[model samples]
Target chain A: MSNLVQTITQSRIWRSFFRHGWPDNPLDRSLVMTSNIFFHLHPVKVNRKSLRATYTFGLGVMAVILFLELTLTGMLLMFYYAPTVERAYTNIVALQTQTPYGQLLRNLHRWGAHLMVLVVVLHMARVFYTGAYKPPREFNWVLGVGLLLLTLGASFTGYLLPWDQLSFWAITVGTSVAGYAPVLGSTAKAYLLGGPEVGQEALTRFYALHVMLIPLGIALITSVHIWRVRKDGGLAANDDR
Target chain B: MTNIPTRTPFSKSSGKTYTLVELVHRAPAQMIDHGPENTVFAFPVVALLELLLTLSVSAVLLFMSLTINAPLEEIANPNQTTDPAKAPWYFMGLQEMLEHGHPTLMAVVIPTILVLFTLAIPYIDNDRQGSGRWFTSERGKRIARNTAIYALLVMPAFILLDNSFPPRELLRGVVPDFVAQTLIPGTIMAAIVIAPLLVLRRSKPNAREVVLTLFTLMFVSAIVFTLTGFLFRGPGFELYWPWNMPDGYNPFMNL
Candidate 1:
C-alpha cells in the first residue's frame, strides 16, 4: 500500500496537479502558498500581530466574504429576474411564490448587499481609527474610497430592479440629487434615467450596470486593493514605527 | 559502533567557498524588529481562518434570509407617489442634507468636498510614525472621542434648530435666495465642523490629529443625519419620533 501510494504521489500527472508535496515541512509549506494563484496574494509568512483578532476585528475579511456571497446569491437571482417595466414586478412575485428557494435567494442577495455596504463602511472606519491609512498605504486608502463609492453605486442600481413603487421613487429621489450638480447636472441625470424619469430605459441601464459594469469594476479594483495591501507590507499592524 | 564522518558534504565545517560581506546596524529591510519566531506560515492558518469566516457568515445570512422577507411594495406608478418619497437608506444622509440647504451646496458641493477630503486624507497627513496603532496615541484617542461626542450633540442640535427656524422661511424676500439657502447654512455648517479644530489648534495639533478630528466629526454627523432621515422622518417628510410615526408609517418597512 505504501509503495503504491508513493508511486501515485510521485507520478508526473500528480506533480502537474500540485507543485508541492504534502506541506508538513517548511519548504513545501512555502511552496504550497507561493505556488497557488489564490494564495499568492498572502505572504507565506504573516506577522502574528497582524493576525490578532482585535487588531482588525476581521472587518476587511467580512467585507470580501459578503461581496462573494452577494455575487453568488445575485447570480442565482438573475435566473428568475427580467429587467422590464411589465415583467419585472411579476417576475419577482413569481420568483417568491413559485420558484423553489427563490425567495430565500432574493433575501440573501438583498441582506448581503446591505451588509456589504455596512461592512465596507465599518472597515473604512477601522482602517482610519487604526491609523492604517497613513504613509505608504495612501494609494490603497484612495482605492478603498473608490470601492466605497462603487459599493453605493452597485446598491443603488440594484434598488431599481424590482420595478416596485419603493424602488421607483427611491431611485427618482436618489438621482434627482445628481441633477443638483453644477453644469453636468441635468445631462448626467438624463443619461442616468435615459429620459425625464424612471422607465424601461432606466431599468435596462441599471440592469447592465448593476450586473455587469459595477461588479466588474468592484472585482477588478478589489483585486488590486488586496494586492496593494500585501505589497504595502501586510496590515499596518505589522509596523512598529 | 563504526565512527561516522563529522564533516558532511553540506555541513558548515566542509564549506569550500564562503564570504562574510558587510555588517550593517539596522533592522531587517522588510520587517523591523520581528524575527521568525514572531510569525507563522500563512498556508493553513490564514486559509483556514478565512474558510471558517466564510462558513459562519454564510450561515448567519442564511438564517436571516429564512426569517426575514425583503420588502417589495406595489408596482411602479408615476402618478401615485409614496407619501414620503425618500432615497435608499444609505443615501438618506444626502436626502436629509437637501432639507437643510441649497441643493447645490448640500447635495453637490459639500458631499463633493467631503469625498475629496476623504481621498486626500493620507496625503494630507503624510506622517509615517503612527501607522499601525489604534488612535496613534492617548492624545489621538481623546481627540477622536471628544470630536465624536461633540458631533453627536451639536449636529442634531443644528438639524433640529435649522428645521424649526429655517432661514429660507424666516428671511423670505428680506435676504437674497442665495444668502438664505446657501451662504448662511454653508457658513454655519463650516463653523460647526471647524470649531473643534480651532479649539485643538491652540495646542498645535499634528496633521494626523487634525484629520482625526475632521474625519470623526464627519463620520458621526453622517450617522446622525442618516438616522434622522431613515428613522425619525415620517409622512410629509416631517420630523417625528421613529416609533410615533403617523398613518401607521413604519420606517423599517422601507428597508
Candidate 2:
C-alpha cells in the first residue's frame, strides 16, 4: 500500500505535469498519434530534411488557413443574412448599416470566400509541383479534386444567397445553364431551383444545399484527404530528388 | 557453414559476402530485447484537442446561423429582367464570352464541355506509377505546362478576335439560335482545351521553360480578357438576362 502510494505520488508523470506541460508517454503519444479522429489531421513525424523555412510545399497549409478564415467570417456574416427574397436585400443593407463591425464582417466573408478558392487552387499547384499527388496519395488527390469542385459549388450556391442583382441574375443564368444538361437538364434545373426559374424555390433549394448538403460533402471528403496524407509517407520525402 | 569458403565469389553485389540458413538474424539494438514498450501518451490528447477545435468551430457557426439569416430578394418577376443576366461570378469568365453569341452556346454546351474537360484532368494525366518515387517526370511537367498555357493564352485571343467583330462582320454578324451560339463557341472551347496536348505531346520542355510559359500565358489571358472586357464594351450586342426587362431599358446602355 505504501509502495503504491509512493509510485502514484512520486512518478515522473506527476512531477513533470507539476513542472511543465505534458507527460508524453509513447503510449499516450501513440494514442494521439494513431487515433483516427485526431491523428489523420496532423503531420505524423515529418522528414527533417523537408522542414526548410521556404518549403514550397507548404501551400496546403495556406489553403487550410484560408478555409478557416472563410468559415469564421462566413459565420459572422450569417448573423444578419436572410435567405428570402423579400428580406435578403434589406437584411444585407441592415447588416451594413445597423450591425457594428458589419462591413468588416461582410468584407471578411466575401473576400475570404474568394481568397479560399484562389488558395486551394494554388495548393493544388504546389502539390503537383512537389509530386505529392503520386501513388498511395492519388485517392486523396481525387478527393481534393472533388473538394475543389465542392468548393466551387459552395461558392456558386452561396453566391445566390446575397440576392443582389449580381448574385441573383448570376445564379439565375447559372442554374438556367444547368437546365441545358442533355438528358436530365430539365429535371436537374428544376430540382436545383426547387421549381422553374430562380425564385423562392431556387433560393430555398440553394439555401439548404449551401448550408447543409455541400458542407457534409466537404467533411466526408476531407477525412479521406487527411488519411491519404498519412499513408503517403508524410509528405514527399524529396530525398532521392 | 560448410560451403561458406567455397561460395564467396558472387557476394560483392549482395552487400555482404556471406549469408544463409546459418546467418544471425537479430537487429543490433534489439538482439536480446523481448517485449514491446507500452507507451500511451501521444494519441488521446491530440485527438481530444482536435475534437474540441472542430466542435468550437462548429459551435461558432451554429451560433451565427441561429442569429443571422441568408439573403432573399423580390420573388421572381418575369417582366423585370436585369440586363446581362449575369452568370455565377465564377462563370464570369464565360458570361463575358456570351455577349457575342447564342443562348445554347453561351448558356449550356460550352460550359458543360469546359467542366467535363476539367473533370478529365485526373484521367488524362494518369501516370502515377513511379517506383515509389516522383509522380511527375520531365515529360509530364511539359505536358502540364503546355496544357495550362494553351487555355490561358488561346482563350483571350479568341475572345478578342471575336469581339473585335473582325470575323463577326465577315460571317454575316450576330446570328441567333443554338447553331450560331452553341456550336461555334463549343468548338472553340474544345480547341482551347485540346491545343496544349497537341502542341507538346511526346515532346519535352525543360522545367524552367515549362514554368515560364505557363505563367506567361496565364498573365496574357487574364490581362487581355480584362482589358477587352472592361475597355471594350459595345452598344450593338444583345446581353442575356435572367428576368425579362422592359425592352429598350438595356441596363448596359451607358456602356
Candidate 3:
C-alpha cells in the first residue's frame, strides 16, 4: 500500500490523467481527451472528399473562430466604448491611443465582421457544391442559411455602434434599403431607426440588436446547426466509394 | 486440343476455385463500412490541430480588437446624406441592379425568387444520387456549377453599376421612372441572362457546357456593364472607389 501511494505521488500521474489517459499510449490519451465534454467541439473524424470542397474549405471554421474572437473583444471593448456619438469617436480614439492594444481590438472586430460575411457566403457555396443540401441534411442547410443572415445582422448592428460618418450613412443606406419594402419602406425606416434619421434612438436600437437580439438568434441557430450536423448522421457520406 | 492445353488446369482436382456465390456479395472490397473504421481521426495529431486553430483565430482577433478601434464619427445627420449612399459591399451587387432599374426588381423580386428557389431545390429533385461529387448524376452538377460561375462574375459588375446609381436627391429630381425600373432591369436581364440561356438551349449544348458558356457570358457582361458605367459617369462621379470614399469628393453635394 505504501509503495502504491508512493508511486501515485511520484509519478505525476494526475497531470497526465487530466490531459491524457492513464494508459500512456498517445491514441488512448487522445480518445480520453476527446471524450471529455470540455474538449469535444471537434469531431473524431472528417470526410476527406468533402474536405477539399473549394467553396469554403477552411474558411467557415476560420470565420467561426473569428466570431468567438469578436465576442471576447467586443466584451472588452464594451468596458471602454460609449454608445453616444459625441463620446463614441473620442472613446475609439482613446481606445486606440490610451488603452493597450486597443487599436488591434478595433481592427480585429472590423476585419472579423467583414471576414465573417465572406466566410458565410463561402460556407453556403461549399454546402451547395457538396450537395450537402440533400434530404436529411436539408433542414440544417436552411438553418445554416439563417445563421449566415444572422451573422450579417450582427455585422450590420456592430457597424452602427461606432457612429462614424462612414458607419452612420452606411447604416442609413442599409436602413433605407430596408425601407424599400413597399408600404413598409417609410414606416419601417421610422421603426428601424426608432425615429426619422439615425440619431440617439437609432444607436440605442442598434445597440440592443447587436448585444441582445442578434447574438441570441445566433446562439439559438448555432445550437440547432450543431445538433442537426450530428443528427444527420455524422459527416456527409461519399457516394463514390 | 488446337489451343494445346495452355493452362496447367489443376483447379478441379485441388478444389482451388470458389463458388459463384463466394465471388459476389462476399467480396471484402465491395462491403459497406460502418462506424469508425479510421483510427487516424482518433489520433492525437488532428485533435490537437483543431484546438490550436480555434484558439489562434480567437486570440488574434482579441489582440487586434484591443489594439485597434472600430469606426465612429460625429453623429447621425438626417439633414446630410453621405455621397453614394452606398449599401454594404455585400449588397453592392443588388445596388448595381437598382441602377439598371428600380429597387423592386433587384432587391425584392429577384432576391425573393432566388431564396425561394434555393429553398425549393431539395423538394424539386427527389433523386438522392449525387451527394459528394459534382456530377451526382449528370444534369445536376452542370446546373450547379454554371449557376455558381454566372453569379460570381456578373455579381461584381452589377455591384459596380449600382455604385453609379444616383442618390435619392438625384432620383427625386431628375431620372425618369420608366428608366429606373423597367428599362434597366429588363435590358440587362435580357442581354445577360435570358439571351445567353436561349442561345445555349438553342445550340442544344450539354448542360455542363452550357453552364460553362453562361459563366463565360456572365464574365463578359460584367466587363461591359462596368465599362459602360465607367464611361457614363454622369454627375455621380463622386461615388468611385477606394470602395469606402474618394478624396476631395463631397457626398453632401447631392443633399
Candidate 4:
C-alpha cells in the first residue's frame, strides 16, 4: 500500500496538481501557503500576538466572512429576483411564501448585509484604537476607507431592490440627503435615481450596481487589501519597530 | 524525514571562506527584530481559526433567520407617502442631524468632513510610539473614555434643546435663514466638540491623544444620533421612548 501510494504521488499528474507534499513539516507548510492561491493571502507564519482574540476581537475576519456570506446569499437571491417595478415586490413575496427555504435565504442576505456593515465599521474602530493605521499601513487604511464606502454603497443599492414601500421611502429620504449638496447635489441625485424619483429606471440601475459593479469593485479592492496586509508584514500587532 | 536547514552552510569560520566585509547600516532584514520563536505556521492554525469563525457566524445567522423574519412592508405607492420617512439605520445619523441643522450642513458638509477626517487620520497623527496597544496609552484611554461620556451626555442634551427651541422657528423674523439654520447650530456644535480639547490643553495632549478625543467624540455622537433616529424617533419623527412609541409605531418595523 505504501509503494502504491508513493507511485501515485510521484506521478506527473499528481505533481501538477499539488506543488508540495503533505504539510506536516516546516518546508511543506511554508510551501503550502505560498503555493495555494487562497492560502497565499495569509503569511507562512503569523505573530502569536496577532492571533489573540482580545487584540482584534476578530472583527476584520468577521467582516470578510460576512461579505462572503452576503455574496453567496445574494447570488442565490438573484436567481428569483428581477429588476422591474412590477415583478420585484411580487418576486420577494412569492420567494417568501411560495419557495422552500427561500425566506431563510432572503433573511440571511438581509441580516448578513446589516451585520457586514456593522462589522466593517467596528473593524475600522478596532484598527483606529490600536493605532494600526500608522506608517506603512497608511495606504491600506485609505483603502479600508474606500472599502467602507463601497460597503455602504452595496448595502444602500441592495436596500432598494425589494421595490417595497419601506425600501422606496428609505432610498428617497437617503438620496434626498445627497440632493442637499451645493452644486452637484441635484445632478448626482438625478443620476442616482435615473429620474426625478424612485421608479422603474431607478430599480434597474440599482439592481445592476448592487449585483455587478459594486461587488466586482469590492472583490478587486479586497484582493488588494489582503495583499497589502501580507506585504506590510502581517498585522500591526507583530510590529515592534 | 528530511530536516529543512534554515541557516546557510557558508560561515566566516570556514577555512576557504571569503574575507569579512564591513556591515552596512541599512534597513534591517524582515525578521531582524523578531524571531520564529513567537510565531507559528499559518496554514493549519489560521485555516482552522477561519473555519471556526465561519461556522460560528453562520450558525448565529442561521438561528436568527429561523427565529426572526426580515421586515417587509406593503407595495410601493408614489401617491401615498409614509409619514416620517427615514433612511436606512446606518444613515440614521445623518437623518437625525437633519432634524437639527440645515440639510446641506447636516447631511452633506458634516458627513463629508467626517469621511475626510477618517481617511486622513494616519497622516494627521503619524507618530509610531504605540502602534499595537489599544488607545496608545493610559492618557489616551482616559481621554477616549471621558470624551465618549461627554458626547453621550452633551449630544442628547443638544438634540433635546435644539428640538425644543429650534432657531429656524424661534428666530424666524429676527434672524436670517442661514444664520439661524447654519451659523447658530454650527457654532454650538463646534463649541461642544472643542470644549474637551480646551480642557485637555492643560495636560499638553499629544496629537494621538487629541485625535483620540476628537474621534471618540464624533464616533459616540454618531451612535447617539443613530440610536435616537432609529429607536427613539416614532411616528411624525418625534422623539419618544423606544418602548412606548405612539400609534403602534414600532421602529423595528422599519428595519
**Candidate 4 residue A2 C-alpha distance from true site, Å:** 7.0
lDDT of 2 by residue, B23-45 (tens): 33432211123222311232454
Tens digits of lDDT, candidate 3, A1-241:
9998667746776655555545347575566647677446545554444344352365556766777767877888899988886787778878878998777777877877877777777666666655666666778877887888889789888877766666787787677766666776778788778887788888888888898899888878887787677566544544335
Q: lDDT of each structure?
A: 0.92, 0.57, 0.61, 0.90
TM-score of 2: 0.65
lDDT of 4 at B13: 47
After aligning candidate 3 to the native by TM-score, how far in Å is the CA of B108 from where it should be?
Answer: 2.1
Provide the interface RMSD of candidate 1 in angstroms, 1 decimal place. 0.9
| TM-scores, each model vs. reference | 0.94, 0.65, 0.72, 0.94
Q: Give stretches of model 3 more than 4 Å off.
A: A1-34, A41-56, A237-239, B1-39, B55-76, B134-180, B183-255
Q: Please provide, for model 1 over B65-112, each residue's C-alpha lDDT reduced to its tens digit, 9 standing for 90 to 100.
A: 899999999999999999899999999999999999999999999999
- Per-residue error for A119 in candidate 3, Å, reads 1.2
- Which candidate tops DockQ? 1
- Candidate 2, Cα interface RMSD: 7.7
Report the Cα lDDT for candidate 3: 0.61
Ranking by DockQ: 1, 4, 3, 2
- Fnat of model 2, as a fraction: 0.24
lDDT of 4 by residue, A92-205 (tens): 999999999999999999989988999999999999999999877899999999999999999999999998889999999999899999999999999989999999999988
Q: What TM value does the first chain of each candidate achieve?
A: 0.96, 0.81, 0.83, 0.95
Stretches of candidate 4 off by over 4 Å are: A1-13, B1-10, B15-32
